[model samples]
Every structure is written in C-alpha cells, then in structure tokens.
Target: MTRKTVRIAMNGVTGRMGHHQHLVRSILAIRRQGGLDLGDGTVLWPEPVLVGRRAHALDALARQYDLEHRSTDLDTVLADPAVEIYFDAQVTSAREEALRKAIAAGKHVYTEKPTATGLAGALELARLAQEKGIRHGVVQDKLFLPGLLKLKRLVDGGFFGRILSVRGEFGYWVFEGDWQPAQRPSWNYRAEDGGGIVVDMFPHWEYVLHELIGRVRSVQALATTHVPQRWDERGKPYAVTADDAAYGIFELEGGAIAQINSSWAVRVGRDELVEFQVDGTEGSAVAGLRGCRVQHRSATPKPVWNPDLPATEAFREQWQEVPDNTEFDNGFKAQWELFLRHVYADAPYHWDLLAGARGVQLAELGLRSSAEGRRIDVPEIAL
Candidate 1:
C-alpha cells in the first residue's frame, strides 16, 4: 500500500480543544485507524509534531503517545521542510502572531476561531494566506455536528419550505473555581485575555447561521457580566471583566431572523448543552448536539390560550425524532479529515480563511452592538 504522510505542526496541543479534539480524537484517531483511506491504493497518514509553550506537558504528551516530535520553539518546528500544515488551537490572544508566522513560512494553516482576537487580524491572516498561495481553513466544528448535519439534511430536502426564524440556546453553568474548580479556564472570564461569551460564541453562531440557514445581515445584542467575580485555576479571586452572558438578535438574508443566547452563568434547563430551534413555514425542528425532533405542518398541534386553565396537551410527544441515518464521527475529527483531504487532494473546500474572518467580523459587530445598544449591520468580508 502506498502511504503518504503529511507532517503537521500542532501548536497548543496542551490546551483542551487542541489535546482532546485535534490531537487525540482527530490525529491520533486517524493514525489508529491505519490512516485515512483515500482509495486508489493510497493511504494518507498524518504525522503530528506537538508544539506548545509547556516543556513538561509537551514531553509528557509526546511520551504518552509515543510521538516522534515535540517542541516548544515554534520557529524550529516551522523551519522543518517536512511540516506541511500548521494547526493552531492557542488562546485567542496568541493566535494572530502564530498564524502570521505560519503563513509567512508558506505552510498550509488550519486553526480554531475566532482566528484572531479582532476582525482586522483575521482578515490580515486571510489575505496573507491568499498572497502566499497556501491552503487554509478554520475549524467550524458545529457545522459537522449531528444536530446541524440533520438540520442541513432537512434544509437540502426542502423539509423547511421557508426558514422563518432560528432560536439558539447555548452554554451552561461554569462553576466559579473557588469551589468546583470551574469547568472552564480562568482566562475565559478575563476580557484582557480575550474571554467572553460573545467573543467566544458569536463566531460559532455566525458560521452556523451563514451555512445552515442564511447569511447574517445585522445584529443587535445585550452582553452582561453576570458573574462579577470568580476564582482562577489557582483558586485566587479575580474580577470577571468579560461578559458571561450575551443575548443577540441577528437578521439574516432572505428575511430569516435568528436570536441566540449564550451564557456561561446559566444552569442547564434544556436537553442539550446547546440547542437550536428553527421554525419554517412548513414545519419546525429543534436540534441539539446529537438529537433532532421535528413537527411537520400536518402533525402540528394547536393549543388554545386560556387565562386560568391548565394545559392538557403533551407538547413534547408531538414531535418525531429525526433518525441518525448513519454513524456520526466527532465533529472536530470529521472536519480534520476533510481539511486533510483538501490539503492533499486539492478538494474544493468552502470554509477558508475568509469564512473565518467573517466569523470574527460578526463577533466584532456583535460586541459593538452590545456596547452601543443598537443594531449593527454585518458588512460582508473579503480577502
């Protein structure tokens, strides 16, 4: 069997998303599966060289995985001609410089969003990547999730005659580190460190809406720092400078309106950690991370509003579950496979650096709207 190995410099693998999703779940998983079968008697194998700031953690990960290369110096990693791709999963504050260096080195880049802390930096990366003539992509993981996949299927099949509106509920209670050791990192609560629900999630909403429903036209948002104080990973008390909750309304192209609430302070009250309810003229569907339930116009139930009477309808039972139809891989892993295919096979991939910049653009606009207390139009971004 002919085997082609693509060496990837995976920066920030010590981070959560980097370690679990990109490294273990995607790269390691692919290698464990005997490389990605490209058919035609060729197998594509990814050789990841772990890159991070922590020497101890990097050494530990490399030793545990029995990996060939690990480095704290990014320049040393990038200087290697064997490395074909530069994958970034670093904190937002540190992403731009790393990405610029990677692009300048003429390596294909794939990274987590917001690709930069601000829109300008993201656009700069996009433009630089284009100028350098290298393949680039941003992780739009939610687009590949089972719930969103099902939504896309329904949309493609014309299950939704006219997408009228979208309601998205995301996030959960991130315990303050003093007691429960907070499920999230301490940096996430500090605005100085690029931490905030709006900064974090608006990018995701932008892509999800743009790809699945429609392009976002404008946004109006209210962002709040619900948890004013929190403890860090070290149990040290700190002021929460970032907004823990953000409620946003986005006007989409084709007259579809979307409202999303992202909160780290809210306790779970729904079926999934994140859920989206899309309403169309013909039907309605509620989609979560792994489940989707739909009620067609024909099966829709009507309930009469009474001032004092108790409701007698089983509203939850009315919707039919959307079948998985096939096996679903981890969203992050699924995207990594596609990115690898794009890099090696020259496959047509749409989620480019420009698409990532649009996410940053939306996030910027969202924050602006929240600050100014008004609707701000989402101007299209270009490379």
Candidate 2:
C-alpha cells in the first residue's frame, strides 16, 4: 500500500485534554496501530508537531512523547506548506482567534467544544470555514462511548417504543484549594476567563439529546455559583464569578422531555460520576460512561407502596446488563480516526463547524434562560 504522511500542527498540546486525550491516547495510539488504512491501496500517517506558547512545557512534553517536531512559533507552523491540519484544544476565550488564523492560513481545522465563547463567534468561524472550503470538525466524544453505542443499538432495535423522557445526572464535588487542591483548573470558576458549568457541559447535552433522542426545541434553566469563593493553585482566595451548577429542562422535537444537572459542587451518590436514565413505553435504560443496564416492561416488578413497612425488593438487581458484543476503542481516538478519514478520503463527516456552532448556540441560550427565569427557544442555524 502507498503511504502518505500528513503533518498536523497541534496547538495547546500541553493542556490536560490536549496532552492526555488528543496527543498521547489518540494520535500516538494511531501511530502505534500502524496508521489508518484508506482501503484504496493507500494508508495515511499522522505526524503531529506539538505547538504551545511555553517553551519549557513544550520541551518537556516533546521529550516525554519522544517527538521530533516541536514549535513555539504558531505562525511559523501555520505557514508551513507541509502542514495539513490545525487542531486547537486551548482555553475557550483563545480558541476563535487561533482558529481564525489557521483557517486564513488554509489549514483544515478541528477543536474541542463549546467551539467559541459565544454564538456569534462560533457562527463566524463556521462561515469562514465554509467560504474557505476547509475541512473542519468539533469533538463530540460522548457519541462514541460504549454505553451510548449500546443505547443507540437498543433505540434502533425498537427497545424504546416512543421514548418519553431522559434524565442526566453529572458531576462530583471539587475540593477547594484551601484544604485540598482543587481537581479542576482555577479558570473554570472565573466568568471573565470564560469558565462556567453551562458553557462547559451544555454542548455535550445538546449533542447527546439530539443523537439519542431528538432535537432540543427549547430550554429552561437555573444556574448558580454554589461555592462563592475558592482558593487557586497558588493558595490565594478568589471569588467564584461563574456558575458552578446548572439545572436544565429541555423540550425535544418529538415531545420527549430531557433534564440534565451539571455541577462541580455536588456529591456523588450514584453508580458513576455521570449517568443517564431514559424511559420509554416498552422499556427503560440507564447508561453510564462504560456500562448500560436495561429493564423491559415485562420484567418490571410490581410492588405495593407501603411507607410504614420494610421494603424487601431488590430494586437495583431487576435490571439486566447490556452485553458488550463488540470491543470499544477510546472515544477520542475513534473520532480522530474518522476525522482523518474525512480529510484524506472525503469520508462522510457530520460533526462540522456548523454543528459546533449549534452547540455554542445551546450554551448561550441556556445561560439566557437561566438569567431571564424563562424558557428560551432554540432556533436552527441557517449556515
């Protein structure tokens, strides 16, 4: 097979998501697996050039990954004729400028979601990408999860005859740095820095609901900063301006109602840090990141409600576990492979900049809904 090498300029690879998920787990994993087979007597290999602002951090990461290419000058990397792709996983506020620059430089673009800080910025990026005719996409990694895949299979097989509702519970307590080091970054609590639970998580809910259930028509939300102040990485106290928790109720196109709760201040009492419960006429399912359990109407237990009596029913054991019929790869890597195929082979890819713009739209509307104390209608993006 003929081998083709594609150079990718990966910006912000020193960050947590970029370094662990995109670089080490996805890109390097693909390299270890002998590249992607195009099935046309050709294979495409990805060569990533680590790009970041900090010289010391970039040097450390490059040495850790044993990579030959590393650059602090983003303009130099972007101007390189050999570079075919430009990926950004930087902080939310910095995304648009870098992406716009990359698009202007004629590089195919991809990035992590809430694609931009606002709806207008996201739409502008999408429009520019379309006008430039550059291949682009945004990460919707949850769609590739094993549990969601099983849920999709069940939905396809008619297990859920006319779905009714979906409830998603996500989050865990993040310790303040005063006593213990905060698990998340300090920027996440500062509104000026583009940090908030609504902006960070509503995009995930939008895609999940749209893919597994139906399109969201409207949203009613209430968001709050549960922890008013917290210590930063340097042990200095800082006011928390961004919301740490968001409670949302969404109406889908098919009359299915979806409710999602995202918080960085909540304690965990469920099976996983995140879980989704879907109910339907024929059956019901509860899915986590890696596991899914289902209960058909036929197998549901009939129990009389007696508050004063001791309950003997094993409610949790009534549901059956979904079998893992196929081996599931890393969700980030799976999407990376598909994106590469889309760029190289012109494969059908739906998660474009337009889709990313829609995610930004959802987050923006969700915040408005919370502030106005009313439901906000979600309009489709024309682009």
Candidate 3:
C-alpha cells in the first residue's frame, strides 16, 4: 500500500487557528515515526504550503518549520498542480469566498466551523462543493473529546437508561487583549466580523447533542453582551458588537431535554472544563473534558445538607479520569487527521459542510429566538 503524500495549501496560515490547525499539526504529523498512521495500514501525511498575507511572517514560519513552500498569494497556490487540498482557517466572513474560489480551482475544501457567517452562505458553499465534486469538511472537534467519548460509551452501553435531561457548563473568563493577550482572536468580539457565542459554539453543541443523544427539535435562548467594550491588541478600546454569554434550552427529538450555558465571563473554578451532567432512570453520569463519573442505582448515595456537613462532592470522589486512549494530537490536528483518513481510505467522517451549515443555522436561529423572545423551531437545511 502506497502512502499518499497529500499536497495541502493552507490559507490563513498566520492566523491562530491556521497556524495550529494547518502548519504546526501538519509538520508535527510528518515528524512522527509513522507519519500520522490511520487504521488498516494506511498512513496520511501532508505537504503544507504556508499561505498568508504577510511575507515576513510566512518566511519566518517557513524557517521555523523548515518548509520550503510559502506564499502570499492564494490564487497561485490554487492553480498549482501539486496542491490536492485547500485548508481554510480564516475568519468566518472570509470563509465562503475563499472556499468558493478554492472549489472553482478544483481543490478539496476543509475549513473551520460555521462554514460561513449565516445559513445562506453556508448552504451555498455546500452546494458549490457538491457541484464541483470536491471533498468538503468542517471542523467538529468536540465530538472527539476524551470526556465526551467516555460519556458516549456510557450512553452506548445503556448506563444512562431512559435519559431525562442534560446540563452543560461551558465557559471561562477571557482576558481583554489590552492587558493580557487573548487566547482567541479579537474578531470574535465583533459581530460584524462573525463573532458571537451562538455562532461560534452552538454548532458544536448541535452535533454533540444530535450525534450523542438526539437531534435538537427546538431552542429557546438568551444572549447578553456582558463586556460592551474591550481593548484590542493595541490597547485601544473597541465596542463589542456580539454577545459574550448565552443561556439556551434545547428540546431533543425524544423526551430528553438539555440546558446549555456558554459564556466568556465566568471564572474557572470547576472540574475539567466544559462539563456536563446527564440524568436517567437507571443511572447518572457527570463528565468534564478530562474525566467522568457514573452513579448507578446501586451506587447512588443520599446526602443531607448541613452547615458542618462538609462539601457533598460526589463527582470528585466517584469520578475517574478517562484514560487518554487515542494517540497524541491537538484537537484541531486530530480532526485534520480524521479528514485525511476519510479522504484517503473512504472512512466515515461526520464533519461535513452540512454539519457545519447546521451549526450556522443554530446560531442564526438562536439570534432570532433572542430577538423574538420565544422558542425557535430549527429548520432542516439540505444535507
């Protein structure tokens, strides 16, 4: 079996996600002993061409990675005969145009979430990719989380029989870029640039809930701009045009219900981040990004609250850290490898543009729900 040396053109390589997702991950995979081995004796490795607007940064990145191909122009790389895939990690607003151009140039497309800022653009991108017969994929990293995988196993094994409800606690205080450099980009704070909790995260929840439990039938949500003004990287004040916090209730296809609280204002004081607890008739499971705890009917413990009762930390005592079963890779990098395996081995990959489009739909609908002050029925987009 011959290993495919995939020639990849990485646009937005200088951006945070671009660097981590495309450049660094690709290089790391190449340096690995077996070159990102997929199952069935197939190995996938990438030949990355760093593409960005700034020449100096591209040159510096090329030097850092020992990559010979670096480019400031996107079209030239798209026209190159060697490039097999176009990887886009640019801002949401620029995603559609760039992907459309890449598809027109006969390149397979893989990009970050939301696919586009709105449902229409996302659908159009999906349609265009289909028309061009190009492989299209969107990032869906949460589905691959260790804790989520554990929770999934519990659910699959019927540990949570007749599930009742789910509660998701996801957030951390994001520092203002003025005083402290932000982990995420500044554009995420501006609505005009396709920034908002609803748009940015709902897609993740959408897939998590749908694939893990059930499909979301409806949603009622509230959004808030907790930080109206924030400082940019230059210490200049900028108006926050997007919501930094969101509280949402999702009614799943079955009787199961879910409450999702996503915010950027909360302080970190909990277990492994982005925690979730699910209740069922037979058992209950609480999980975080790194661990999980299950309490069956036999293991259920009753407690009484008292001033001197100490903390009723059931999860802390009962939970076990989920072993890191999968091989080492960053979240974005793992997803990228999955995409490559899907492309080369014809393996099933769930992170397609339609899934990405569904995320945008959820975000757009959440906004409508907030504006209308009512529950919104999530309409299905063509897959």
Candidate 4:
C-alpha cells in the first residue's frame, strides 16, 4: 500500500568492493537497474549512509551521491534506529565482527561473499543470524548474469539431457598493481588478509555449479603461485602468499564431474571472457560471458586437433553466438535489486548466507585437500 524506504549503512564504503558494490552499484546507480519482479507493486530504493574510517573520504562520497549522512563511527551507525539494514562490503577478515555487531544492534544484513575468513566463522554467522531471526543475505551475483542466466534456462529446459561434464575456463591477466597501480588491494596478495583465488573464487563456482548442475560432493585441488614476488605502489618487493592460480576437480552428486581452472596468468585469446562448456548425451552447449553456442546430435562430427593447421582450416565453421533476448543490466546491480525485493516484498532470494557457507565449505575442503594430498568430501551445513 505504501512505499518502504530502506536505509542502508554501508561498512567499508571507501574500499574497492565497498566503493563499487556499496556506493556506485547499490546506491548512486541503482535507479537504472531492472529485473526485480516484485508483484505487490511497491517502489523500493535503498537510502545509504556511507560509513568509513575517514570522514573526509565518506564526506566526498556523501556529496557525490547527494546523501546527507556520513559517519566515521560504525557502532553509532549500527545503533541508529533509522538504519534498517546493515550492508558489509569490507574485507573478508573484518566481516564477522562487524556483522555480529549489526545483528546485536538489531539490523538485517546483506554482505559480499566468502562470509568469513574461515568456515567456523561462517557457520557461526549463519547460526547467529537464524537465532536472531533477521533477514540475512550474501552476494551470489554470478547467478544473475545474463550469460549465466541463459545457461540456467538451458538447464531448466533440459537441453543437456543426462549431463556428463562441466569445464570452466576463467581468468585474465591482472595488472601488476605497482607500476599499473594494481586494481585490487595490496592485501589481496597477502595471506593474512584472507586473499587468494581459492578463497575468493571457490564460493562463486560452488554456487554456480550447485545452482545449474548439481551440488559439489567432493573436491581435490592444486594451488600454485605463478608470480611469487610483486611490487607495491612504492616499488617495495612483496612476497605473494596467495595462489595466483588454482586447478580444481569437483565430483557432483548426480555422477557429474566438473573441473574449474581459475588463473590470473592467462592471456585473453577467445572472444568470450569466461566460458563454461557442458557436455551431454544428446547435445552440448558452451556458455561464455555474453553468448552461448549449442551443438545438437544432428550436427556434423567433431574434428581432430592438428598442429599444422590454419585457423580456417581447423574447426572454425561450427560456432554461433547465442541470441540475446532479455535486456540485462550489469550482473552486480541486478542482484542488488533482487536483494531489495527480498527484503521488501518478502520474496524468496536463494543467494543467502547459507548458500555462501556452501562455498566456504568447498574452500575449506579444497585447502584441506591441497594440504593432505587427498580428496576432501564436502560437508553439508545445517541450514
């Protein structure tokens, strides 16, 4: 009947993900977003208060967004009766403490992925959120990507009957943050800050695999640090404690096998950015970031690879770009609207902390597997 204005206090609003996901994506740029079908017919937009350690920085953001409130005090912001939702985009190591305080302060929480530095903290967060009876959610933005959504459609349509395998190729050469002024934080290469491809990305693939194909029952991985030394902004050499790349094998519940190769070392060779190719008995589909190509059983037989072959002489004539029909926003903002509706309209949003914990479980398992040189069985969390 009436519009409910949700006030959000953004923790770590000045940092990388915080600046984008909190300021640019959620608040300042949310009006242009679409795809949230809240049937009750109510207008919902998040009113945000930028919370950071520096007043001047937050004040600049407040001015840019035309927002009136900027606070250096996290406790004050959490305790404010006017703020209904607490959003945390802080680093993974800092998340649990802030989230716990938000729950104690009586505000619902929506946060970025890898909910905690370790699985124990993640489990505790989930337990406390349930005990407090608050609406809690985690960012599973990849599930909302148009390309990934199309893959979801294919799965729902049963195009790939009795799926056999899934192979994901994901990565690009990240800039050397020193001379190039690295795109990510300095701590991303440091082990103490919960930085690594295994921790940062496994949760994403866990949800992607579970949502589209099947749940991950077991995982075995080998992590490597390709470029072990890097320089910071000032030319000081820093030893990289995190993995620059990871090769993982997942055994799904339905006899499906999935392998994910995530790296920062690969050069972009194909037209697509990230690709997930699924093979089946009747047909197969290869999904990229923007398009997909399908090969039915009626298509010509596959050709063999040859070293002494030109581009056109090889397998070049069979691929086609997937038709893009639905107008999709950038993946980040799409999930933002869904989260708003999940809070306002009481809509069922699957990307919650429980889902995040599933990934944390996978990462923990992968680390254990890497350490023990054995396959680790994924343990189910009691949601």
lDDT of 1 at 70: 92
**Alpha-carbon runs more than 4 Å astray in model 2:** none
Model 3 C-alpha lDDT per residue in residues 173-274, reported as the tens digit of each score: 998777787777788999999899888989888989988898888999999999888887777889999999999999988789999999998897877669
* Clashing residue pairs found in predicted model 1: none
Q: Rate the local accuracy (lDDT) of all candidates.
A: 0.93, 0.93, 0.83, 0.82
RMSDs, each prediction?
0.8, 0.9, 2.3, 2.2
Query: Model 4: number of clashes?
Result: 1
- Candidate 2, residues 305-327, lDDT tens digits: the string is 99998998988999999999999
lDDT tens digits, residue span 154-245, model 4: 88998888999999989887777666766567677777888888998899999999999999999999887887887776768899998878
Lowest lDDT block of 10, candidate 3: 319-328
Q: State which candidate, 2 or 3, has the greater lDDT.
A: 2
* lDDT tens readout by residue for model 1, 234-286: 88999999999999999999999999999998989999999999999999999
Write down the TM-score of every candidate. 0.99, 0.99, 0.93, 0.93
Q: For candidate 4, what is the TM-score? A: 0.93
Order candidates by lDDT, high to low: 2, 1, 3, 4
Residue 84, model 3: lDDT of 90
Worst ten in a row by lDDT for model 2 = 374-383
After superposition, candidate 4 runs with Cα above 4 Å error: 32-41, 304-316
